[model samples]
Target: MTKPRTILVLGGARSGKSRHAQALAEAMTPEGCFIATAQAWDDEMRDRIARHQADRDERWTTVEAPLALADAIAEHSRSDRVLLVDCLTLWLTNMLLGEADLAAAGDALVAALEDAPCPVVLVSNEVGFGIVPDNALARRFRDAQGTLNQRLARVCDATDLVVAGLPLRLSGEK
Candidate 1:
C-alpha cells in the first residue's frame, strides 16, 4: 500500500495559503474534508469565519475543531479522503489558551499524520519572520508556533510556502 501524501502549507497573513491549499486539495482528491480550527471569539472573527464558509463549495465536508485536531484528522482521514486543515496557528492558539499540553499535543498530531490512512494538507501561518514582540506571552506564542511549523515541515511529504498568492514548493516535488 502507498503511504498517504502529506503537504504542509505555510505563509504569512493574507499570503494566500488557504486558497492555494484548497485548490491543491480539490485537484488532488475527489473526497475532501475541511478541518477548521478557528473559533469566533468576537464579531470580527465571526464575520471572517462566515466569509470563509461562504467561499467553500458544497462538496467539502467541514469540521469545526479548535482543538483535538489530531483526533479530528484521524477520524476523517481514510484511504480515499483528502483532509485539508485550514490553519494550524489557530489550533495552536486554542491549545495554548486552554492550557493544554503543547508538547504532547504536537507529538500526538505528528504521530497521527504518520498513521493517517489518506492524504493530509496542513495550513499554517508564518509568524516568525517579522519584528520581535514586546510582550512575554506574544513572544512565547511566536516561538512555539515557529517551532511547531518547523517540526511538521520536517515530517511532511511536501512543503510549500505561499507568497503573494503564489505557491513555491519547497520540497517533495517531482
Candidate 2:
C-alpha cells in the first residue's frame, strides 16, 4: 500500500488554494472526506459554504469541524480514503473567537496529521504577505495564522503556495 502523506496548501484569498487542495485529494482517491472549518455566520458566509459544498459530488463525505478540527481528522482518517481540510485560517479564527489556546490547538492539529492513516490536504490563507493590520485583534490573528502555517509546513510532506490560480511547490515532491 502507498504510504500516507500530508500536504499543506497556502495562498491568499481567491488564490485557488481550496480548489487546488481538493484536486490534489481527488487525484489520490476515488472517495474522500472534506473537513470544512467554515461556519456560516451570515448570509454571505452561508452562500460561500454552499458554493463549496456544491463543488464536491457524491464521492465525498462532508464533515464540519469549525473548532474541533483535530478530532475530526483523527476520527475520519482511513487508509483507503483521503481527507481535504479546506482553509485552516477559518479554523484559527474560530479558535481565537472561542478563546481556545492557540498553541495547544496547533499542536493537536499537527499531532493528528502525523498520526493520520490517510493522505491529507490542508488549505490555509497566506496572510502575512499583506500590510500589517491596524487593529490589535487583526494583527494578533495574522501572527497566529503565520505561526500555525509555519508549524503545519514543517510537518507536511509537501507544501504548495498558490498564486493567481497557479500552484508553486514550496517544498517536497509533487
Q: Which stretches of candidate 2 lie over 4 Å from their true place?
A: 1-4
Model 1 agreement with the true structure over 101-163: per-residue lDDT tens digits: 888999999999999988899999999988999998889899889889989999999899999
Q: Which candidate has the highest TM-score of all? A: 2
Question: Ten consecutive residues with minimal summed lDDT in candidate 1?
Answer: 1-10
In order, what lDDT does every prediction score? Answer: 0.89, 0.92
Model 1 TM: 0.95
User: In candidate 2, what are the lDDT values of residues 1-174, reduced to their tens digit?
Assistant: 333388999999999988899889998889999999999999999999999889897989999999999999999998899999987999999999999999999999999999998999999999987888899999999999999999999989899999999999998886
Please give each candidate's TM-score: 0.95, 0.96
